[model samples]
Target: MLWKYLLGFYMLLVTAAAFLYAPPALGLGELSRIIFFHVPVAWVGCLAYLVSMLNSIAFLRKQKLEYDRRAAFNAEIGLVFTILATVTGAIFSRYTWGEYWSWEPRQTSIFVLLLIYGAYFVLRSAIEDEEKRARLASVYSILAFISVPFLVFIIPRIYSHLHPNPIINPGKQMEMDARMFRVFLASLAGFTGIYAWFHNLHSRYLKLKAKFEEAEKHA
Candidate 1:
C-alpha cells in the first residue's frame, strides 16, 4: 500500500520532469517532449510481449494452465499498451507530419504487430476446450513473439522513414543532452514500475477468479 503511494508520487515527479526538466529537441520544439512518454510506453509494451512469450514457453514445457493464464494476461496487457503507443504516436504525427497517419514504415510495422496479437485473442475465442485453447494459444504466442523484434525494431530501420532516431541506438553514441537523457531514463523506469504493479494486481485477480470458478464447479 505504501509502495503504491510512493509509485504514484514518483510518477508525478517523472511527469513534471518530462515537461519542465527536459529541453526540447533541436528542431522539434515542444513536441519533442512526447518522446519521454511515447518511448517508455512502447518499451513497456515490448517487455510485456517478451514476458508473455517466456510464460508461453514455460506452459509448453510444464503443461501448466497457470503459466498459460499468465501468458494470456501479459499478452492482453501488451496489446493495450501497444494500442496506447500507437495512439500517442499518431498524435505526435498529427502535429509533426501534417497528418494523423502516413503509413510510414514505423506505423505500418506497429499496425502489423497489433493485427498479429489481435489474432491471438481471436484464436483463443475460437477454441472451446480449455487445454486445447491453452496449448494452441501458447504455441501461437511463442510464434507471434518471433516477429515482435522485427516489426518493432528491424523493419522500421530497414526502410526509409521519418521517425526520429532512437535515443539509445546501439550503433551510435547518444547525442541527447545529459539532463534530457536523465529524465528519459527516469520516465522509462517509472513506466516499467507501473507495469510491474499492474501485472501483480492482475495476477492476483486471476488467482481469485480461478478459485471462485473452482469452488462453483465443485459446489
Candidate 2:
C-alpha cells in the first residue's frame, strides 16, 4: 500500500521533470521532452516481452500452468506498452516529420512487432485445451521474441530515417544533457517500478481467479 503511493508520487515527479525540469534539445526544442516518457515506455515494453519469453521457457521446462499464466500476463502488458510507445512515436513524428506515420523503418519495425504479439493472443483464444494452448503459446512466444532485437535494435539502425540519435550515440557514449540524463534515469526507474507492480497485481488476480473457478467447478 505504501509502495503504491510512493510509486504514484515518484511517477508524478518524473512527469513534472519531463515538462518542467528537462531542457529542450537544440534540434527538437519542446518536442524533445517526449523522450522521457517515450523511451522509458519503449524500454519497459521490451522488458515485458523478455519476461514473457523467460516465463514461457519456464513453462516449457516445468509444464506448470503458473508459469503460463505469468507469461500471458507479461505478454498482455507488453502489448499495451507497445501500443503506447507506437502512439507516442507517431505523435512525435507528426510534429517532427510532418506526418503521423510514413512507414519509415522505425515505425514499420514496431508495427511488425505489434502484429507478432497480437497474434500470440489470437492463438491462445483459438485453442480450447488449456495444456495445448499453453504449450503452443509458449512456443510461439519464444519464436516471436527472437524478432524483437532485430526489429527494435537492428532494423532501426540499419535504415536511414528521420528519428533522432538515441541517448546512447553510435559510439555508445551518453551524449544527453546532465539534467536530462538524471530525469531520464528517474523516469526509467519509475516506469520499471510501475511494471513490477502491475505484474504482481496481475499475477495475484490470476491466482485468485483460478481458485474461484476451481471452487465453482467443485461446487
Candidate 3:
C-alpha cells in the first residue's frame, strides 16, 4: 500500500514537472518539449544497466537464484528503456539533424546494444537447465556491462563523426544554466524512482511465481 502511494506520488510529480519545467529547459518554446521523455528514457536505460551489473556480480559471487532473477529483471527493464531511448533519439534526430535514420556512430552503438540484449533474452530462453541458465546469463550480463561504456562513450569519442562531445572535458570548467540543470536532474530522479518501483514489483512477482510452482510440485 505504501509502495502504491509512493508510485502514484512519483508519477504525479513526473507528469507535473514534464509539463511545467521541460519547455524552458530545452529553450525551444514548445517544440523542445520532448526532452521530458527523451532524457528520462536515456537516463533510465543507464540506471537499469547499472542495476543489472550489480546484480550480476551478486549472482556470480553468491550463486543465488534470487540474484539471477534480479539480474534478469534489470536486463529486461534496461532493454525496454533502451528501446524508448532509441525511438526518442530518432525523433530528436529527425527534428534537429534533418534525418531520421543516420548511420551516426552514436545511433549505431545504440542499435548494437539493442541487438546484444535482444540476443541475451534469446540465449536465456534457449537454455533449459536452471543452473546453466543462471551461469550463462550472469556471464553475459557482466560482459555486456563491461562493453557498454566502450559502446556508448569511448567509441564515439575515438571516432567521432557528428555526435556532440561531452560538455565537461578533462580539467575544463563547465556551467549549465540553473533551470536546465534542475529540469534534467528532476527527470533523472523521476525515471529512477519509476525503475525502482517496477524492479521491486518484478522481483516480488518472480518470487511469488516460484513459490507457487514449488507448492504445486510438492502437492
Clashes of 2: 0
- Once fitted onto the true fold, the runs of candidate 3 whose alpha carbons sit more than 4 angstroms away are 22-29, 152-154, 158-176
The residue pairs in collision within model 3 are none
Give the lDDT of residue 131 in candidate 3.
Answer: 84
In order, the Cα lDDT scores of the candidates are: 0.88, 0.89, 0.77
Better of 1 and 3 by lDDT: 1
The TM-scores, one per candidate, come to: 0.92, 0.92, 0.83
Per residue, candidate 2 scores C-alpha lDDT tens digits across 77-158 of 9899999999999999999999999787867877876897889999999999999999999999988878667676777666
The residue-by-residue lDDT of candidate 3 on 1-219, one tens digit each, is 597787678768776766775545333445455666776887787778778778888988999888888888888999999999899889877877789878688778778778877888998999999888999988987887788777767665665476443433688754444655566677777788788888888988998999999999999
Superposition error at 2 for model 1 (Å): 1.3
Candidate 1 worst ten-residue window by lDDT: 150-159
Clashing pairs in 1: none
lDDT (C-alpha) at residue 18 in model 3? 64
- TM-score, structure 1 vs. true: 0.92
Higher-scoring candidate on TM-score, 1 or 3: 1
Output the worst ten-in-a-row residue range by lDDT, candidate 3.
Answer: 22-31
